[model samples]
Target chain A: MAIAALAGFVGALTGLGGGIIITPALTLLFGVDIRYAIGATLVGVIATSSGAAAAYVREGYTNIRIGLFLEIATTLGAIEGAILATAVPTSALAVIFGTVLLYSAWQTARPGPVSAAAAAPDPLAARLRMNSTYPTPEGPRAYQVQGVGYGFGLMAGAGAISGLLGIGSGAFKVLAMDRAMKLPFKVSTTTSNFMIGVTAAASAGVYLNRGYIDPGLAMPVMLGVLAGSSLGARLLAAARTKVLRALFGLVLVFIAIQMIYSGLKGAL
Target chain B: MSRDGGARRWTDERIEKLVGNLLRAGVLISAAVVLVSGICYLWHAGTGAAEYHFFHGEPSPLNSVSGILASLRTLDCRASIQFGILLLMATPVARVAAAALGFYLQGDRTYVVVSLAVLAILALSLSGYWVR
Candidate 1:
């Protein structure tokens, strides 16, 4: 529970989910099965994502239209991925998890990403009426959405990762919306937060049904994450998070290496 | 971007606020249920060794809603925790369903369909009607 709270606090500050820390920690430190770790981490992921989204949505940073549209792809992919989770070899899953963790560390260690607003709206986006505005110091500023097809495809991939690994995959979601679809960074981040809950819910249902969700472990993690993320959000404005994010990234790198080593040696 | 941009923005804000409040309520209620039930669980089984190193899936009854509800009648704390988790899962489904209704009211037929499609997938998963 303490580890969960710490993971939740750091993950919220870094714009990730507790799963990245929770899963590896459970497997390596506590001797929990990888599948059970994933199931419980997923519960924490939903709590943090949905809890944070409540604040983000009210602040007008969320793009509900884009979020809902992308969820069609995400939900479909999540169910497929959840089904695959039960069938995939545990070693292979560990290796994949480690590799993804490496990628997440790289992403976090990098400098903050700039928004990729489009010069012109994609015709498909315009036709679908997916273009929208976000609030700014000046006023509500209009931004065009582009690469709808590519963004949708990436969102589906993000969902698959979320289900298979039981992580929020928020970084990938931001990559889809900000880098692919060219929404503003704040818009992408908050909108990704909004979509995370739905995407996780889709796979969580399958996990629950398949008996992957053990309530004894899941409930405490959920409560811990919810409490930690809420406090993290409150502290965000006052906290100098640069050093903290870099430190968190370094920790992920260490965890990733250990996970890969364990996977290769079949110690898991 | 369009002539009705201002009106659309207003509607979006209202809907966003409503969605925000709804999500907050869901999280709070879920947390409360989980907290209460988790305490009961620890009280009953705190001294037992945790059996999570192996990946045995849950029992047949605990995996389904009907079974969980039945367990709750006997004051089984584990089932109560599952019930809370069920509520947590349902929160997002409710959000999607509300969005579908909102879009329908807004007359954005395309997004309404889009939201419904997502909701359908959620429904299938919750019902355990999908491929095992």
Candidate 2:
């Protein structure tokens, strides 16, 4: 529980949900089964996402319209991924998870520009009213959304990865919104955070039905992540997140390598 | 300046606030339930006994709703934990439902349909309709 709490704090600070840390820790340090770890990590993901998003939504950084619209794709993809989870070999899942982790590491290492391009909005985005404003210290900042199709496709893929691995897949979501959709960085992050809980919940339902959600394992993880994220939100202003993020990114790379090695050896 | 437009904004804010608080409260209540149940579970089964290396298949007797409910009636710790997790899972579904209502009230047909589609997918997952 304490480790989960720490993982949640780091995840919240890093804007990656706790599952990334929790899954690797459970599998590596505690000798927990990958399937059980994924199940427990899903609960933790929901806890942190929902707990943190409550504030983000009220703060207006989260674009509710975009979140709801994108969820149409994410939830569907999550269901399909959950169905696949039951049949896919665990070793294969580990390899895929490791690849995602490495990609996330590269993403973190090279932060992309928050596209302020004055490009024309997609017809679908305009029809859906995907353009929105986010509150800033100065005032409300307006931004236009573009690439609706690409963003939706990316979100569906992110949701599939999330369902399979039990992480928020926030890196991909942020990439979709910030790069493809051309939303501001803050809006993209908060909106991604808001969307993750629902995305995870969709898959969690399937995991629950599959009996992957063991109460004995999930209870502590859920409670621990909730407490940790709440505390992390409080400490965020004081924490030097740049250094912490770099350190965490390194940790992710290391874990990714380990996961790949284990998967290759059929020992995951 | 129209009353309809003014009312629409009012309802939108109301729904957003309600949904935010609903998510907050759901997490808190479910976390509390999980905490207490965890404590009980830990007391019953010592912490050091979990063998993480082995794959112990599905957790039986608490896999289905009926099974969880039956166990919960007896105040079983594990069942309570599962129930709390269930409540946590329900939070987002409830949020989507509330958002759909919000869209309907705002007369936004596109979003209403979108939210309902998301909800339907979630419902399908929960219904175990896709189980093989």
Candidate 3:
């Protein structure tokens, strides 16, 4: 429970989810089965997303319309991924998971420069009215969204990975919105946070019925992650983003290497 | 168009506040349920050994909603935990349902349709109609 709390804290602070940390920790440190770990992590992802999304939404950092629209793609993809997870070999799943973690580490380590705002409003975005203004230290900064098709495609992939691994897949969501759609980082992260819970919920039921969700393990994890994320949400406004990103990147790289090694050795 | 923008912004703020509170309440209530069950689990089975290296499917008694409730009636700690996790899972579905309603109330026909699609997907998964 304590470890889950710590993972939730970091996850909330970094715009990731507790599952990213909790999955490996459960499998490697606690010697838990990969399937059970995935199930438990899915529950923790829901808890953290719910607890943190509240604050982000009220702060106006989240775009609910964007989140809702993208969810259609994600929910469909998540169900497919969850079903496939049952059929995939554990070693292969572990290797895929490790590769994703490495990608996450790379994503975090090399932050991209802010893209130039589009002069021409995207037809799809304009039609959908996917534009918003976010409050900054200066004032409400207005921004226009672009590349809706690309963003939706990316979200589908994010959802598939999330379902297969029982994670939030926030890194992919952020990339989709921030890079493909030109949403601000704050908007990307908070909206991703808002979307993640729904994505996880779509698959959690399947896991539950499949008998992967162990109550004894899930109880402490859910409560701990919820508590930790609630606190993390409160502190996010005061956090140093660059420092957190750098440190979190290092952690992800380390974990990724270990996971890959374990998977290859058939130890996980 | 500017006037329409102003009105949209106003509605957006209101919806954001409402949704925020809803998410917060869901987490709190579910977490509280989990906390109670967690304490019970630790108290009763804290010292027990649990193996995690291999897959052990959950017992039939804890697999479904009906089964979980039945176990809870017997004061089973594991059932309580499952119940709490169910509530947690419900939180996001509730958020999606609320968003659909909010769009309908705002007369956003397109978004209402979009939100409903998302909700339908979630509903299908939860019902075990499609995922199974």
Top TM-score: which candidate number? 3
Pairs that collide in candidate 1 are none
Instruction: Indicate the DockQ of the complex predicted as candidate 2.
Output: 0.74
Q: Per-residue lDDT tens digits of candidate 1, residues B31-63?
A: 999999999999999789789989999997888
- Using TM-score as the measure, name the better of candidate 1 and candidate 2: 2
TM-score of chain B of each: 0.88, 0.86, 0.85
Model 2 steric clash pairs = A31-B52
True contacts kept of each: 0.89, 0.74, 0.89
Alpha-carbon TM-score of each model against the true structure: 0.89, 0.91, 0.93
Between prediction 1 and prediction 3, the one with superior lDDT is 3
Q: Across residues A1-268, which tens digit of lDDT does each residue of candidate 2 receive?
A: 8988987776666556767778878887887888788889998998988888787677677788899989988887887788887677768778877887798778766665544566777888778887778776678887888889999999999888788777777767877887788887667766887788899988887787788877877877888888898886566444453565576578668768877877887866
Best model number under DockQ: 1
Better of 2 and 3 by DockQ: 3
Q: What value of lDDT does candidate 2 attain over all alpha carbons?
A: 0.79
Ranking by DockQ: 1, 3, 2
For residues A210-252, what per-residue lDDT tens digits would candidate 3 score against the true structure?
A: 8889987787778778778988888877766577668667767
Please say which candidate is ahead in TM-score: 1 or 3.
3
lDDT of 3 by residue, B1-132 (tens): 764664575586787788888988988887888888888888988787777678879997787767887888898877888988888888898888887777776777888899889988988787776555
lDDT of 3 at B53: 74
Question: Candidate 2 - CAPRI tier?
Answer: medium
